[model samples]
Target: MKRLLVYLWTAPTTLVGLWLAPLALLTGGGVQRIDGVIEIHGGIVRRLLRRCTLLKGGASAMTLGHVVLGQDRTVLELTRAHERVHVRQAERWGPLFIPAYLLASLVALLRGKNAYFDNPFEREAYKRAP
Candidate 1:
């Protein structure tokens, strides 16, 4: 099951090009290929190239190995730590963690906290980033 989900998560951007994917670039850093997966700071994002209808604002999307974030305004802006955090969360929780992560993220947003900062997963990514 983990392998299947990993395959699904990585199929989109891996098949294409990392540059062409919906990756967030840090101020002085960018995506890097590591031993296991593409490591963006402490966050591990899956790459897949597919015809997706979940993108918003533009023709490109940077989803976190899921079908959500489609047409999401936040997803519109490509931030390094923002998306990277989701990657780490997915890594620790596996594929079934999206729903819980999304809920927590939304609650944090409603509380007027920065999603990328207040989010536990994102917090980890940011803390571990160089």
Candidate 2:
């Protein structure tokens, strides 16, 4: 079916996200499956979100293929709509999503724009969710 194909197409990125799941679990995080997406939060996930991102405080939530990582369950709940927009983006771009997203950020910065805020993908997500 079409859905299966989309999952297959995005599998590589999904695998990358899933690679973090064990770290989350071993460190006391939780995982859930919602609307065919895997959601993860807490433990090292929170720290990673706080320190590993380009943002000063890092991101509260991030989407990778069919997986979403959040600082916590509450933040995940709050950002679901916005992150869903990214899920659709990942579905559209498949394995190229990350590269395309990074490229968008670089382009935004080169244009003297706020890379995260001005990236077209973020703009679209904000338009739908903000």
Candidate 3:
């Protein structure tokens, strides 16, 4: 199952590599940098779109302070705003932030709620996705 998931997630990246090679380090298309935003389109980034059912265009990623998975191109797409929320979380909590986020997600899973939506980090991410 893990392998299957990885395959499903990685297949799109192959195409992305061909398409985004020229702009790999250029930042804008392959790795865009706006006033306060950063868009990534490359091999590593393609996985974000492949894995997430909500994304589009072969998957693109962004990192405000951390990494964001922008699977699609809607305003609600997992864009910089969403990533920025995580940036805030990391800043406020310091280094223990990721572990705490993971723990909270595990708790939510144990409780049977959809962790992606119920997890506080994800909630913040989604709420700020626009």
Candidate 4:
């Protein structure tokens, strides 16, 4: 089934996400299953998020495998569609997703482009986001 395929495809990254679940909880965030996706919200992630200047005013939620981590409930709702596309990308790339994404961004930056906006993954997600 498609669901099984997706689960298997993203299993590696999902495992990583599961490991971070406790940290999410510790930050006053909780996890939920929504439309077959694992959503993690709240906690110290928001405070820590501010440290990532690259994400300033841009990223509200990020998807790692089937898990989506958000700054808050409102941000989660707003970015759900965008993050879902990233879930699919993670399924497609498996454990290679992170490194590949970073490489893409680095290449973009070296070429004097906006790393996030020029990265193929973000472009794909943006195209599919509402």
Candidate 5:
């Protein structure tokens, strides 16, 4: 099936994203499938989003392959559209998504742009969903 191929193509990246699932679960976070993606929130997901990213106050939600990590359930709901854009991007980029994403950020930084906001991927997501 075409869908199966897409899943397989993205599986490597998805596995990288899933690295945090158990940690999230053990730390009091939660996980559920929504619209064919895993959405995770609370516990360590909360702490990571609040402390570990490039944003001043941290991101409300982040998508890695088919996984979306959020500060909470409400944040997940609010950012679902935005994060879904990233999921589609992952489908397009396949296993190369992370490296390509990081490269895009680096390119933005080198060009004197805000890495997060100016990265074309983020730009696309914001344009489509914001």
Candidate 6:
């Protein structure tokens, strides 16, 4: 089935997502299955996310594999489509997505570009988001 293929393809990132699920749940947040991806919302995720200074430019959500961690429900709703693209990227890149994304940011920074906006993954997501 297509679903099975997607599950298998995203397994690596899903495994990492599993580790974050508990934290999300413990912080009063919850996870939901959306279009075959797991969306994590609410709780201390927002505070926890403050650690990612690279996201200083108003990024309110982040996608890890099949899992999405949002600052709040509203932010999640607004960005679901964009995050889904990231889920698909995770499916394609597996666990390598994180490092590859970071590398892309680093490359952009080296080029004196806005790291997040110039990163190819972000550029793709921005282009796809509605």
Q: Pick the candidate with the highest lDDT.
A: 2
- State the lDDT of candidate 4 residue by residue for 1-130, as single tens digits: 9889878878888776666668888868877889988887778656545555366564577787988878888888899989999998998998888888889999999999998889999999999985
TM-score of each: 0.39, 0.98, 0.52, 0.87, 0.96, 0.87
**CA RMSD (A), model 3:** 11.3
Question: RMSDs, each prediction?
Answer: 10.4, 0.6, 11.3, 1.9, 0.9, 1.9
lDDT (C-alpha) at residue 72 in model 2: 98
Against the unseen true structure, what C-alpha lDDT does each candidate score?
0.44, 0.94, 0.50, 0.81, 0.92, 0.80
Evaluated against the true structure, the overall lDDT of model 6 is 0.80
lDDT of 5 by residue, 1-130 (tens): 9999999999998887687889999999999999999998998989989998878999899988889999999999999999999999999999999999999999999999998999999999999999
Ranking by lDDT: 2, 5, 4, 6, 3, 1
Cα lDDT of candidate 4 equals 0.81
Candidate 2 collision pairs: none
* Model 5 per-residue lDDT at 99: 93
Residue 61 alpha-carbon offset, candidate 5, angstroms: 0.6
lDDT of 3 by residue, 28-82 (tens): 3344444433444544345545674322443344332333334333422435566
lDDT of 6 by residue, 1-130 (tens): 9878877777777776567677888988877777767777777676766665487644588888878888878888998989988988887887688889999999999999988889999899889985
* Candidate 5: stretches off by over 4 Å: none
lDDT-best of 1 and 4: 4
How high is the lDDT of residue 39 in model 3?
Answer: 44
lDDT by residue for model 2 (1-130), tens = 9999999998877887988888999999999999999999999999999998868879999999999999999999999999999999999999999999999999999999998999999999999999
Best by TM-score: 2
- Measured by TM-score, how close is model 6 to the native structure? 0.87
lDDT accuracy of residue 42 in candidate 1? 14
lDDT: worst 10-residue window of model 3 = 9-18
Whole-structure CA lDDT of model 2: 0.94
